[model samples]
Target chain A: MKIVIVEYGMGNIRSIVSTLQYLGVQDVVLSSDFEILNSADKIILPGVGSFGKAITQIRHRNIDNYLNEIVLENKKPILGICLGMQLLGNSSTEDGNNKGLGYINGYVVKFDNSLVKVPHVGFNQVKVNNKLKLYNGFNDIPTDFYFTHSFRMKSDVEINQCYCNYQEDFVASFERDNIAGVQFHPELSQTNGLKLLKNFIDKF
Target chain B: MLRKRIIFSLIYSDGYFMQSRNFRLQKVGNLNWLEKNYRFQSIAFALDELIVLNASKTEKNITEFAKTVSDLVNDVFIPIAAGGGIRTLEDAELLFNSGADKIVLNSLLFQDPNMVMKIIENYGSQSVVASVDCKLNLGSYEIFINNGTKKLDYDIQKYLIYLEELGVGEIYLNSIDRDGTGFGYDFDLIKIVEDITKLPLIIAGGAGNENHLAKGLQINKVSAVATANLFNFIGNSIPNARDYLLDNGLNLSNRVFDTLDLI
Candidate 1:
């Protein structure tokens, strides 16, 4: 199966490609080409950086339209990581109020500086919800995944969501059928991350 | 339950990994020698993060170091932070493109605050890590930059508060006095600086064994502890240290889902 990592001039695309290949999925491409993105079996939206700037870059390449046509309309499986996951929501307050792709029913807000650390770096425990395809083959409820972000998402909508606590509980991973998003870098989460990538490929 | 991290830092200088002690550099080996000796790919699974710093004192070339960073992280499945002399946005971008999950900046925090702000504006503050090389002089804590060659005339605690306001994601506080000494970390300095910043603190430089790491983690303020002494942390030593930490009931990740489990 081919996995195309949507590369619209963002962070850690090379690492994502390398990690996919390490999982024995060699036919991976990093590009914004519509044909290549649409033709793939699975697509990954991986990013690290400011939300406003990332949307600006995505819009510059018209990737927003492509993702709409391909992921929203076509029902192709997509996984958004970190900032990419935040971008899948409605909007983010980081770098000022900016709109996201609106694929998921959520919005990003910065962590309360008075409560916990701003950028909650390092490994944190994630409580998986209902054995979704993104976390299949795992029975453990709360597992460690590497998280690095200042802004976070909170939603009251019902969905397959994984919860993690820092200063307070926040969404770790949310699955809406073929579309899923995780606020942690599964690529950097060691075996737990690799297992997660494999589940997305083989099960999702 | 957020887990504390054990990070291994590899010091690089001119295409070679160096063993540093008190800011003194000694070339230990090239990439092949590192692979043959430490088996870093297998070793990477045992730790939470890997940090590769290009401590090149002579004519620092970021492009070359980024390529090395890419090479080292190809199949190594962990969060890798690469930096040393990142002075520009392009330099930070190059390292990120080369597989660095985060960029480490030392001198840039003191030299060009505008450039640092620009990076934070473009890449988000979480992508940039402020690395502080600190030392104790005349019973006062001082911050050093430019690979420990130049000392900034500011208190270490105050510098961290400044860094926090700049919106850096994490603070990599390395004690120059304890680096590679196998003695231990400067817990006193850590106590003073830890109270100042709300960002995640990664304490480095001077961990001789698992006991030192445990002691560092036992503190309520420290988020992670790191070691750069190659002799003390190469090969199975990392995995052993991790197992020891886990066996002792310290809060580290369990490797039940590791790649080896797939094999």
Candidate 2:
């Protein structure tokens, strides 16, 4: 299968590509070209850095157009990791109010620094919704995944959401049919992450 | 619940990985030898994070070290923090582009606070890890920088507060006295500074075995435990240690997926 990882001068594209290759995926391409994304069997919207800057870069490359066509119109399965996941939400309050792809029904906000440490780093337990294809093998258990971000997403709608609690529970991952997003780096989460990525490839 | 982490650190000097003992470098082997012996691709399963530091006492080359980091991280799925001689923003950018999820800073935090702030501004606070080397002297912890060679005028408590003010995400506090001794972590040093800052603390320097790792993790304030003693925990030692920690009901991530199933 041809897996295209959207690259816009942000995120850990190298780690995602290397992880995909390790999972025996051969035709992995890191490009923001419309044709490359459109031709992909699956699309991974990997991202890091600020939300405002990320949105600007995505628009500059016209990746928002590519994603809309390939993922929304053509119905290709897509997985967004970390900040990539946040970009799939309705909007984020980071770096001024910035709009997202609105692929999922969620809003991103900064973690209450008064309540806990900002930029919650390291491995944290995520309560998985195994009913979703994104968390197939987890068996509805709490699993650890690497998280390093200040802003988190929350949704009122039931989009098959998984929750992780730092001080308060927030959306850890969600899957609405073919579209999926995880607020952790599956590429950097060891076997469990690899398993999740494999599910994204096969089950989705 | 946020789980504690078990991290493995690899000290690189020149072209070889060194066995560091009390801040002294002893060349062990090259990257090929490391892969042949440790097989980090597989060993990574046992670790929560991996830190590769360029401790080259001579002139440090960011490009060459970054290349080694890139090579070492292939197929190893975990957060890799690489840094040693990051003097410029481009130097920090090179390592991050190479595959580093976070950049470790030591001397830069002191020598160039403005440069450190610039890096944090560029990469966000979460992307920077401030590594502080400390040695106990006259009933107080003394701060050391530049690969533990130079001493700083700042006290340990004030230095930690300074790091927090610098907006680093985590603190990698390494004890120079117990560096590679394999005895255990310096609880005396850890106790004094664990609650000083709200940032996650990763205690390093003197972990010999699984017991040492467990002891370090038992501390409620410590977020992670790191050991660079290559000779002590070789082969399947790390994997066994993880299992041991899990079996003993430690609050570590118990999720295990067989990646071999993918192949």
Candidate 3:
């Protein structure tokens, strides 16, 4: 059960390693090596360009203090998608105010063009906030995936599990326990985004 | 509560799949016949992001056919809107990390109207969608760009009131002389952008039948209505247009077109 995605150079890493080898997930590892992303068990990261060049390439490969000491002082299980879920929050206004990976509290704003339309891309519908397990077997409230961002996560955080509405209501999936975040693109989401990447690889 | 939205548009060229109203050109299969039959029957679907416009290929084969249709519709559950030739903000962040949930921007909003406030400051104006390929000219209905080829003197109701002060959640007004010519929509230019913007408007080209999507949903200020040759050359689908809009009584949005059989 070794996962480790976090490539750095900024997104589309061979389509998230061909969507984790089309969900068969043969011990996936793209690595930017922070000791193999702190000896992985499961830590996916997947980002896609600018947010100050992916937080200056994760503080120029200090790997953001070994991903805040393996997902906030050794909790383990991590998954961040879409600019790696806006760099796991706590700071980001986009081109000016930086600092994120605060491990999830909230701070990424920039897509409220008054009502909607700004990198919100396509295929959206998600509501699930019922105590997440990476939406185990999906569907609790809205559940239609695949999203492109422009900065979200505001709705007064607190690990928002899911919430999507285009011109307003933001945060579309966020967890704190083992650190999870999904603004959408569960490896380009297809069969419930490959059953949410095989339920984050059957929770490792 | 208001959630019913279905759209299915796949008109690519050169790299394949382009047969909407006899343009003829099909190849790219395994669309899994749209997920083994319209993936829970369309509440929202679209991929007509215009095959990299004016095609002829190469931007590395249109980013390898947009990453093979974003990895074959990344487990499609519903809502999918990808629009043609998106301009920048890194081509909408590589089609939102290649799985797109919504990104329809037309000719880069008339070639950079501040790239729609820089894609609502990087993906937020409801994931940015503002496509207007209108026509009418003299009597006043302008806003055309690229695909409809040039024309913009502005005033398509003052550029949808400047795309409703640049926060545009959704507006896909299309109608280029009744696109593909089925001749239905343009309900007076969708009642002039639904009498000046409330937002959520998706009226593409001329619809054809189903009473022109039941007169654009009996003008309750159209929230969604799209037709590419009335469901790809009159096959109809989306449960036959939601059973002809609930047998003409109207009032849709019952999530995913409300469990269909329509026969």
**Most TM-score-accurate candidate:** 2
Could you arrange the candidates by TM-score from highest to lowest? 2, 1, 3
TM-score of chain B of each: 0.97, 0.98, 0.30
For model 3, what TM-score does chain A reach?
0.34
Single out the weakest 10-residue window by summed lDDT for candidate 2 chain A: A132-141
Model 1, B59-147: lDDT tens digits are 89999999999997885878899999898999998998888888899999988989998988878877888999988999988889988
lDDT of 2 by residue, B194-243 (tens): 86878889999999999999999999989899999999989999999999
> Judged by DockQ, which candidate is best?
2
| i-RMSD per candidate, Å | 1.4, 1.1, 10.5
What would the DockQ be for model 1?
0.74
**lDDT of each structure?**
0.88, 0.91, 0.64
Off by over 4 Å in 3: A1-76, A81-84, A87-91, A95-98, A103-147, A151-184, A199-203, B1-76, B80-123, B126-128, B131-154, B157-161, B169-171, B176-203, B207-263
Candidate 1: stretches off by over 4 Å: none
Rank candidates by lDDT, best first. 2, 1, 3
Q: Which one wins by DockQ: 1 or 3? A: 1
Q: Give me the overall lDDT of model 1.
A: 0.88
